[model samples]
Target: MDFFKFLYRSRSAFDYADDNPFGISTLLNAIIKRLQQRRKLTLLLAACLCLAAPCYAHAHIFSPLLEAILPRSSSEKPQASTAATDTVTSDTKITLPTDLSNPSTTTAPAVELELTKQPRPPLSEPSLYALLDAEFAANRGNTRRALVLYKQQSFKEDATAVFERALGFSLNNEDVHESLDFAKSWLDQNPDHVPAWFYVAHLALKAHDYTLAGETLNRILRYDPRADLSEILIGIYPENDDDQRELLAALQPIDSQQNASLSVLKAGLLNQFNDPQNALIHINRALLTQPDYVPFITLKADILRKIESTETVLSYVNQARLRNPDSKNLYLYEIRYLLDLKQSQQAWELLLKAQNRFNDDNEITLLAALVSLDVEQYRTADQLLNILVKSPAYLDQAYYYLGISAERQQRFEQAKYYLNAVVREDLVLAAREKVVSFELLNDNIEGAINTLQLLRQQYPVFAPDSYVMQADILWQHNEAEKALQLLTRVSRKYPDNELILFARAQLLDDSKDYLIKRTLLNHLQALDPSNLSYQLSYAQLLLANNRSSEQGLELAKNLIQIRYDDPRYDNELQLQALNLLASNALATENYAQVINYLQTPYDVLPTLRSGELLLRAYQGLGADEKVEALLADLQQRFSFGQRNVNDRVQLY
Candidate 1:
């Protein structure tokens, strides 16, 4: 029988007359019969009745009714009505009502189930099996279904694990916001998880939440003291100096003693801001703990160098070498220190030691070659450069230095070959200039001209310099008119070109055409009125033409006095002025003044012309012994070709 028929029979047996006045059984029977015909309509009425009643009313009303209609087997045990609650399934538990006769126990007359008050049951093994399905789906690359399953499982059991899986899947699908939310929930469950913290910190950094990132990093460090966060922090370059300072300040509370790498990074940042003094303090602190750490030592040395404590730099680098004897970089640092101190020989020795230790290292080889070049050890430089040229890392620089080494050794052809091999754009013009110079030095005038021409065509940026070089070569070949014409043409093309104008003036001065020379010099001076070199040239021309000898002498004397009074004045200017003064004095037969002017030092003489004039002044003063000594000194110090003593000694 259906529930309604059983209920009606039971009610009839109990109190059939008054309690059943409403005929609940008859109505229930009608509903049941109708449910067979219209099941949807029956479900709708049952849902409405269930919603309309209180939860305790349903229990009080149903318990006795169910007990009366459903006969229990002898083996079946009855549940106590006083029990508060019991589990129904993995997803649900139901609470039983209190004593129905108690007024306080009474609920609303309508059946209203309060499922929210019941404690949920723990997920069963079937839910775990569903989690496995989620894993499989995720593995199968069905991320959408897997996320839904994982989320549903989170509400069931092991929410941390569920959230972690969801996060992993979300990240795999590149759903960053979802992944972040899942990660946050997972971390909330397990805050001490280091890997999770790393993701949080990384994402925080990406989001530019530096404070949060720093806190996360600190938490990670507390858990694992040896975590290397130096690279991560260093990679975060701020937008401005203030932001960088703020970042460094944020990191300062972390113990530098525990992380020396962080200290070194801060020192580097400080050095970049030109705060070498403070930078040194941090670097030294790091070095104290990590004396054998090569990078810290190198940073300390660099900071000291920036502050210009050369002796201290040398001492620090030497100490670093003792601690890290096998460190090639320390050796390089020492070499660089010595070179900066102008102790070239010491630098060369250190470079050789570095080469022996790191025989295959190209950087050491390049340094050795460059230092050898500096100390005039051409053969050693040449050998090192030959090895360096084979390595692409140092090929162009090696070729450039090899050319210089060969040129120093007077191997012009080899120098040209090496120079030509230099293809680095920065080195090309310099290499071409050297090639042209070497060609001229080798007495191949035509070759020099050809090289300069090619250089002009290939590197038009250097065309003006090439033009000047070509003019000089033509002038050396006694082709004065050709040289002058070349200078004129280039000067017109590059009117403001000082080099071309200077070359033109020189040719005119050589031809003794003072008027045109003065005009060109005036134009140059007009272009740069403050140019002392141009002023000196103009004065020299004035003295040469004897047009304004006294005025020229006075101007030259004033220039020399200016150079003497102000040590910052150009040495070349001082030399030129002295040469002019001495020449004018010699011409005027002012032997005493000439002696006073030129007797400062032989080193002070600007050129061979000044030296010759000094000698003539000594001759005019009738000091034969002084003359012979000066003559011998000049002949030994200078290469005066096959000219007689008088011819060599003649100024102009």
Candidate 2:
């Protein structure tokens, strides 16, 4: 009966007993039997009632419904209050059936639900679509709209991916201030992100905010001590000394004694700013920790050289060599220093030692070859250069040296082949000059002229030299008129060029135009008054013309007295001066004096001209036995179809 009444009140006020009295009685009997069998039947009945309605309005109905369905125990005490209260919190509210059996109505207290704040969940699929939209805008060059959407998404979720994308887009668009803001936001969220710190530093550097950039770099170094500062420092172009000092000040604090790389970097920065003294201090500090460090040793030597402390530079290099005897760089440095000191023999010896140690090193081999060439060991240089010709790094230099070695050996074809292969701008002119000479030596006059044309077309900087070479070739071939025309054309084009002027003068001298020759020589002397070669040439021309033989003889004597041991003293010029002196002496009939001047032994003498002059002096002295002995020796020394000494020299 109570269940029927409960259902009756849940739907409407209708009595099922009135409609079907027998059915109501049967249903009541079944419910009573089930309740008697099991006390949990009330929950089943309440669930059925809830299912049948499916739209309960209030949960308070459950209080009355349970009160009527559940049988109270005999010992259970009743509360004084007539109302029952139940509170529930869930996504959906469910109302229970109210009791209608009791005439005194059961009143259920209203359900009181409390709400509290909950954290927001992560962005879901819809947010991803929004991000895709942002990407589309960014890709379509709508940066303003894209930044708006990106900021919305980033602030909504603060994802690392979103932050990175926004930052990169801003930087790619050259919105440095926007990129900086994004970097700051990223760092704020992820303080330990090294890449974010680097981005900030880069942006700061672009903005010329050295302080922020340096601070950011310092943060990076704190995270990774081995990070290369060179990449960051490359963009930092300080405006003046004060700016440079400011940058140095910022870097110095980060350079600790334990970090040798940072110290070296700081030293390099200081050196770049022309503060080598301070750079030396930092380098020494680094060396104190790593005394045998090769780069530091090299840097120290370079700093010493910059200060003109040549001896100290050598000593530093030697110290480094002692520490690292097998270091090829130190050996090369010492060799270069020796070469700079005009110690070719010493340089060659050092290079030989280096080659023994680093035989497979192409740079070492190349240096050895160059030093060998300097010492006139053409065969050894040829072997080394042949090995280097296939190397990409040394190909041009190797070909150049090979050409020079072949030229030295008088192998004209081989010289032309190697010289043609050279392409480096610094060596190209020299190689072309050699090629021209080889062509002329081979009697290929057309080929020689063609090469000069090509050389002038390819390298205009050497056009004057090419013009002079072409003129010389024409003059050699007895095309005196063409030679003079070419010389005049080149001289007019390069009016101030001493080489062209000298070429024209030589042509005039060949024509015995002594006045014009003297004027040209005077102009050359005025152009470079200290050039000993020009002075000697002028003196020889004066002697040749017999204009001032005494004055020319004194000048020639003074020039011959110049020590030829110095490499700067041109051997060819000295020999010319000696010949001029001997010729002037012979003109004056100073026979004994001429013999004394030309009496330098044939073995010690460098030029055939000296021997020829000596033979003339012997003829002047009427020393028949001495002349016969010299002639026999010259014939034996120059044995390959050699001409007689009388034919070679003008025997007075």
- When summed lDDT is taken over every stretch of 10 residues in candidate 2, the lowest stretch is 94-103
- Candidate 1 segments exceeding 4 Å error: 1-316, 325-329, 340-346, 353-362, 374-383, 390-393, 510-515, 546-570, 603-607, 639-652
lDDT of 2 by residue, 350-460 (tens): 898889889899989998998898899998898999888778888999998888888888787888999998888899988898888777777999999999899889889
lDDT, candidate 2, equals 0.67
Compute the lDDT for candidate 1: 0.66
283-402: candidate 1 lDDT, tens digit per residue: 877777667878787887788888866777788778779877889878877887777678999989988988999999887888888888888998898889889878887899999998
lDDT of each: 0.66, 0.67
| Estimated TM-score for each candidate | 0.52, 0.47
